[model samples]
Target: MTQPAQVPDATHRSVDVPGGRIHLVEQGTGPLVLLVHGFPESWYSWRHQLPVLAAAGFRAVAIDVRGYGRSSKPRDIEAYRMLAHVADNVGVVRALGEETAVVVGHDWGSTIAANTALLRPDVFTAVGLLSVPYAPRNGFRPTDAFAMMGGPEEFYVSYFQRPGRAEAEIERDVRGWLAGFYGVLSGDAVPPADGGDPHFVPPGGKLSDRFPDASLPSWLGEADLDVYAHEFERTGLTGALNRYRNMDRDWEDLAAWDGAPITQPSLFIGGALDASTTWLADAIKAYPTTLPGLVSSHILDGCGHWVQQERADEVNRLLTDWLRSLPGRARP
Candidate 1:
């Protein structure tokens, strides 16, 4: 697949992975920092962080995970599983001509990054996660999540696991889906001020309605939203939705590790206002207990689910500082 036009201060590139071409944007010239984005978003999610990292003297790279943006979109659901996702990151780092890189991930990408560091520590010098906490293998099940939230009514993730239903619902109204996802990230977009009320529902079942109403963070603008919408429009919801469908398989696969903790220095960042914080509260606190190297956790005020994009300046500052503190800098 062809790469998209390079955004100013960043240039697009593709690296051939096991499945097909992997799309990435690289900028600056120092230690390498690879930024991985999650669901319903592309590398564009890190648009704000790229320049800041680069300006701070690091070669920042943001990638479109498999099946998102211009990257290869494989039809097989297994191809999107955790092991494959980790392999893809290994391939990207190797392909970039770097032996190791400072790896960072958000949302689904956070899961992958955590697993990558655990399963393939050679490829990452350090790791950072956002939004989601590191739920160890056999940590908790989706069914457990549903029950903890007081049944299906309070959990969107459980809703994601319903085969064919979520894709059909989101695809049936793409605009509303995009808007809802967008709304949840910005503090001003939702009805209950928190995304958890059983009665809370976005227009057309859209997820963005969960967000607050202020303008999106400086990092995300109408143009960025357009870019994401266009990508979703092309791929539809099938590929993305498949991610949720594989949760059981992911859980099973991860279970083999039996609570293996991430040994590398790590950081976690999230929007204080995001409902996910409520969901993973205990897991976050217990992370350091499980992984001795887990060093910091920050919850940005006024931000929601999309913490990086919703609070770009603060996220960028924290990320740059964390990157600088890594044991060894990227040679590049």
Candidate 2:
């Protein structure tokens, strides 16, 4: 795959992993810093951090996470499983000539980064999680909780539990679905702390119906949206949405890591308006306890789900500061 034409200041490359070739963008020269993006986003999601980390004397590499952007996109639900994705990430670090990398991720990517650190500390020496908290595997299946829901209308994840359903609805208007995902969760795009906007779109309704914003946020320009739209159009959302489909299987697969604490130097950053803080409040409160090596945790006031993108400077500052603070690594 080639580099995305739209994003600036980075070079794209691919790493051959167990399942397929993984696409990524790289910058700089020193201890490696790996950035993993979340759903509906690409390596461009880390556009701000790449240059900054490079400038601070660290090699920064951001990837498409298998199912997105210039990377290989597999159709099966099992392909998006976290362990497989984790293996690909570990492979990226080694493929890039580093025995270990400072792994950082946002949104669903945070879950991937945390799992990698927990299961393969030898490969991921340190971790930095954004938006999502790393909760210890308690042998509890999240899919079972969704199963007890009154209906799919209760939560979007429940709605996404079924394969082929969300893809049919959202892919019909990929741009709108992307816009709605950004709009509702974004602080600037919606009222602050209103709680009036619906988080889950009921069946038969277009995803855009939940996004009351007349237009996309100013920061996310049409040019940026085009980059994502083009990539998703090529890959389709099947592999991407497959992450949500395997929650039960992921839970069962992670039983081995149950009660295991993430025993690596870690940093966490989140936006105050990010819904994960409220919806997953239990995990947020238990973050330090679960992640024994948490060096710091910060939530930027007045920010939202797209924390790294929306508040790039703050995110960069927090990240670089944490990188400098970590105990001396053999590579660093």
List per-prediction Cα lDDT, in the order shown.
Answer: 0.76, 0.81
Q: Give candidate 1's error at residue 198 in angstroms.
A: 7.6
Q: Write the per-residue lDDT of candidate 1 for residues 123-219, one digit (tens) a residue.
A: 7868899988887877677557554663434456666666676677677767556765666555555454654552234434534335445555454
User: Candidate 1 regions off by >4 Å?
Assistant: 1-5, 143-149, 152-154, 192-219, 330-332
- TM-score of decoy 1: 0.88
What is the number of backbone collisions in each predicted candidate, taken in the order shown? 13, 0
The estimated TM-scores of all candidates read 0.88, 0.93
Return model 1's CA RMSD, one decimal.
3.2
Best by lDDT: 2
Candidate 2 lDDT over 218-267, as tens digits, reads 56888788778878877888777888888888888999888778989998
